[model samples]
Target: MARLAPSFGHLVFILSLLQVSVVCQTPDNVNSLLTNLFANYNNKIRPVNDQSLPIVLDVSMFLFSVNAVDEVNEKLVTTGFLGLTWTDDLLQWDPTLQNEIFIIFLPQKDIWKPDLVLKNGFKKLTEMGGDFYFLSISNFGDVYWYPYEVFETRCSIDITYFPYDKQTCNVTFIVWSYSADEVIITKSSGGIDFYEYEENSVWTIVSTDSDIKKDSYESEITFTITLQRKPRYYVMNMILPVVCLGLLSLLVFIVPADAGEKMSYSVTVFLAFAVFLTIISAELPVNSESTSILSFYLVLQLMIGALVLIISSIQLRLHYRKSSRGMSKFFVAIVRIDQFLRCVKRYRLCCKKDVTTVENFDKNEEEQSTELEAAIEWSDVTNAIDFLCFWFLLLVNVGLTMFLFLYITGS
Candidate 1:
């Protein structure tokens, strides 16, 4: 029993020492080890033993979402997470002492990170991380880094097609201070994520592609974003109303010339066409090189409306002319044209009746003369002109509408 007592005491002492050793290596001790790890090393510069050995940085980007794209300012705003990983022998440590496979440190506080800039950006993302900086070191001398960024990039736009246009905008990242030989940049996998994108209200994402471009001294990652504009709103609001206004111009021929409102009605339709032109012009880019087909059609319709207004004015003057001014040479020529077209068949019938009256009513001439005057008055030239113009204007309207429709659809 006495020998067993000393052995038990020795066992208890060894167990107590083991417990103390385990408890002593707490988080504070880990921090102490980290302090020692950075003691002799300068984290401000690249952790390379030889200054001539170039730092090869493997960069990759993954898109999370697109926030907004401002057309007026020509900026593309996006949110994504990207990583920059490189090998640094100086940051490596033995993992056996701490029983940890890797250690994490804030790049801002503990290490030198690559300075990457957006070459075509309107507003650059700040380095002050929204979350923790991704600076991790493995026991095998590998350093992994990453940062979440929101970039507002500048892009040149092609507004020739306006609401129907497809645009290709680029997001490029370049090393700020390093030459190609000093720091090499390479892509990770298939650069960006395409399947996880959310829907956009005004634009649809058509396609996305990424490629690395290198010049003599510069290297960059250029991501091309292809977007198509949604055109339902423009077609419904702008195009349909203009077509309705064009159809309204045809009403001038329906209203009789003697109604006293024919000229005024045609002028009103002409003015309405002009107003729509102004409205559409205000919404689109004025400096665009390609003329909008809608604009061209509106101008053609305006010209047709103006011609109708002028023709109505002429018809009204002919209908209301004083008898003292009696058939001028111009009026005679128009009557001959109506005769050639067989539009004045009533005039021919009246002439035959007058000849019959002159022969048969030689005996009772006074009564025959009165009947002849009434027939002559009913067969006036203005009535023939009204009949001819109505059919002519109706044909013109139908032909133009058909032509314009086919042209627009085919184009």
Candidate 2:
């Protein structure tokens, strides 16, 4: 019994020792599992380095070129954000992330190579960055402009392997936004009464080869605008208003010279021109190297005003001369001078000899010494005014019409 008890006791001690060994072994296994889990997680997070990856990987970027042509002294220009020429899809902005960008200018091989560095240049861009590059002209204004874009990588690598990953990726393309065109002005084929010219526009690209692939992307542009009417200066100043002035002057024959309407008509004609003058001057340059057609018309209007003033003065002198016949010869000579200017040598005022321009009217039917005297001849003054007004007004209108036609037709 004692022997059996001791054996049983040994067995229990042995089982306890085995349990301790298992517990100790369990901690080591747990530690190993934890280390393996962490190591696998990190391996999945990072991609293979240069050894596994290659440098010659595919990338998204833009490619561009400039074109020149004969239709205009203009060029077609384009821009690419990334260094790629093609996009997987035609419709998309530059990829937010990209590998490269490039710009190419296709000038005519025959034409002279421009001194791009002197004015517009790509030097600043090469100085700026390797990836976000620029190759266009720059004014640079004055000081430094290109301290940031370009750089030389210090790390070295094999040339044969391309550094590309197999995961999903994107590529983008860029296009030109703006270009400058030239204008052409040449003589028209259709002959004109006077010399004239016409203007036209077009867009063009320049290249020596007949087939330019880049020009296919370019589109044509045309401009359309509105036209306005210009007013005539000569007729507005000299002719149309003269018809009314003549009508007003004719009233002198209908009413008495002593009545108020004659002086009013003369004054109205003068003031009407003053109003026209104010308006015309506002349109014309205040000072000019050569006088305008408007100025010529105004001078004629001034002469008409002077004639009216002369008639008014003569009439005033005649009225007082009815009481004092002292300067009768002088008044007669003045009447003859007026007659010649009016274009009717037989023109006269009342019993006076020939006179021109509306000299004066006969006594009114109500005021005449006799009703017969009221109907006395006033034909002298009327004839002179008719002849002069007809020719002067005709000249003014014809000149204005021709001027307007020539201006509008570009003659």
Q: List pairs with backbone clashes in candidate 1.
A: none
Which 10-residue window in model 1 sums to the lowest lDDT? 349-358
The residue-by-residue lDDT of candidate 2 on 194-262, one tens digit each, is 112122122111111111112333212111111112234434654446545534433343444556556
The top-ranked prediction according to lDDT is 1
- Model 1 CA RMSD to the hidden true structure, in angstroms: 11.7
The segments of candidate 1 whose C-alpha lies over 4 angstroms from its true place after superposition are 1-25, 64-73, 105-109, 124-134, 141-144, 194-196, 277-282, 285-304, 319-411
Q: What lDDT would candidate 1 get against the real structure?
A: 0.67
Q: State every prediction's TM-score relative to the real structure.
A: 0.69, 0.30
**lDDT value, residue 124 of candidate 2:** 33
Backbone collisions counted per model: 0, 33
